[model samples]
Target: MDSLRADAYLQHIGVPRPGTAGAAELRALHLGHQLVVPFENLSIHLGQDVPLREEALVEKIVDAGRGGFCYELNGAFGGLLAALGYEVTLMAARVFGEGGRLGPPYDHLALRVAAADGSGPWLADVGFGRHSHFPLLFDSRGEQSDPAGVFRLVETPEGDLDVLRDDAPQYRLERRPRQLADFEATCWWQRTSPKSHFRQSLVCSRLTEDGRVTLSGRTLVVTGSDGRQERELPEHEVLDAYRDHFSIVLDREPQVAPLDA
Candidate 1:
C-alpha cells in the first residue's frame, strides 16, 4: 500500500496526520473523516450493485471519491486505519430491521481497536449513520459520554454486551472479532432487498465535535451541543440539503417523500 496516498486522504478529509497512533488522535481523525466523507447508497439507485469485496470498497471510496454504507465504509476505513498503524478488528452487529424485528448476522460492520497502552480493546465506529462522536471503552461496564450521545456496554445474560446510546439499546455486541468478508450476505441483502432500511430510505448522518446531524428521507435535521431542530423540506430542497449540509453533490437527485408519504 502506498503510504503517500493514504496520508493524502488524511489531508483530504482534514484529519491531522499524527504519525503515532494515540487514542485521541485516532478519534479525531475518524470523527473528522466521517463528517467530511458521507456514507451513501446512490449506486444502488444508479442500477449499480455494491460489491462485498474489499478492493471494490477501496476503489469506490479511496479511489473513485465516493462513500458507502457499513460494509464498504467499515471495510475501507479499517484498511486505512491498519495502514495508519492502528490495529483494527471487524465485528458484526445484527441491525434493528424495521417493525422492531432483529435481523441476521453481518447486518452491520463495526470496529474494535486496541488501546494505546494495550488495555484491552475500544469500540470505534463512524459508519453507524448515527452513533457516538467519539470512541467508547470496550471494557467499560458503565456509561461513556461523547459529543453525539451517551454510550455504555452492558453485559447480557448470554454474556454478550449490549451497546446503548443515550440509554437507547443500539446493537448487542458480540465479543468475537471478525473479518470483513464475513458480512458479504448481509451486504447483499441491504443493497438488494426492500425489507432492508438502507434500501428503503436515503439516510446520511455523522457526528461532529460538538453534536450530530442527520438527513433522513425528505427531512433535514441538525442537532448541536445545545439543541435539536427538525424541518420539513420540499423534494427539491432535499437535494440542496444533501449538497450544502452533507457535502455531497448528487448527479441524480433523490425524489424524497415524507416518511408517511
Candidate 2:
C-alpha cells in the first residue's frame, strides 16, 4: 500500500498518524476503527463476492466506505497494522456457533500484536461484534474489563485458550499463528453456505458512543445510554436507515435469505 492509501485508511478510521506503533497507539486504532467501521455481512446477503485479500479488503472497507465480517475487517486491519510497522500476526479462532457448539477451524480472524516496548503480545480484534471494546492482554489470566463486557482468557485442557465474555464462552482461540490465506476456505463457506449465519441474516450494525445501532433485515434496533428501541421499517425506510445510520448507500434493496438450522 502506498503512503497515500495509508493516509486514506487513517482518515477513514478518524485516527491521526502515530509516529510509532505502540500498545497505546494500537489500542486507539482498534477502538477508532471499531467505532467508525461496522461489523456486517451485507455483501454476503447481497450475493456479492467477499475477497480475503488485503488490498481488496482495504478497497471495500476504507475506499468504498463499507463494512464486512471477520475476514474482510480483520484482514484489512492486520494489513494496516503491518504497514504501520507493528508486529502483527494473523491468528485463527473458532467461534461458538448455534446451540453453543464450536464452529469449524478458521472461523474467525484475530490479531496478536507485540508491544512496541517488548512487553508481550496482546489480542487486538476489531472484527468481533459485541466483543471487548479494547484490546485484551494476551497472557493475563485475570478478568479484563471493557465497555462491551468483562472478558477473561483462560487456558483449556486441550491447550487452546478460551475467551469468555461476561462468563459466557465466546470462543476457544488457538495459539498457532496463521496466514490470511489459511482462512480462505472458511470464508468461502461462510459466504456461500446456507448453514452459515452470514448467508442467512441481513444485519448492519456499529458501535456508538452510548451503545449500538443495528438494522437487522427490516428491523431497526437502537440501544443507547438512554434506553433500547426497536421497530420494523418499511422497505423504503430500510434503505434510509442504512444511509443515515451506517453511512452506507446501497444501489438497490439487499436480498435477505432465510436462516437455516
Give the number of the best model, judged by TM-score. 2
Off by over 4 Å in 1: 97-100, 225-227, 255-261
Task: Tell me model 2's lDDT, rounded to 2 decimals.
Answer: 0.87
lDDT of each: 0.74, 0.87
- Candidates in order, TM-scores: namely 0.86, 0.96
Residue-level lDDT tens digits of model 2 in 3-25: 77788999999999888888888
What is the C-alpha lDDT profile of model 1 across 1-261, one tens digit per residue?
358767766766788777676787777777877877677766766567787776677777666667788788878778777778788898888665456566777778888887565644778877877777677888888878776678989898988777888877788767788887778778887766766666677777755555667777767778886889999888768777777776667776654333333
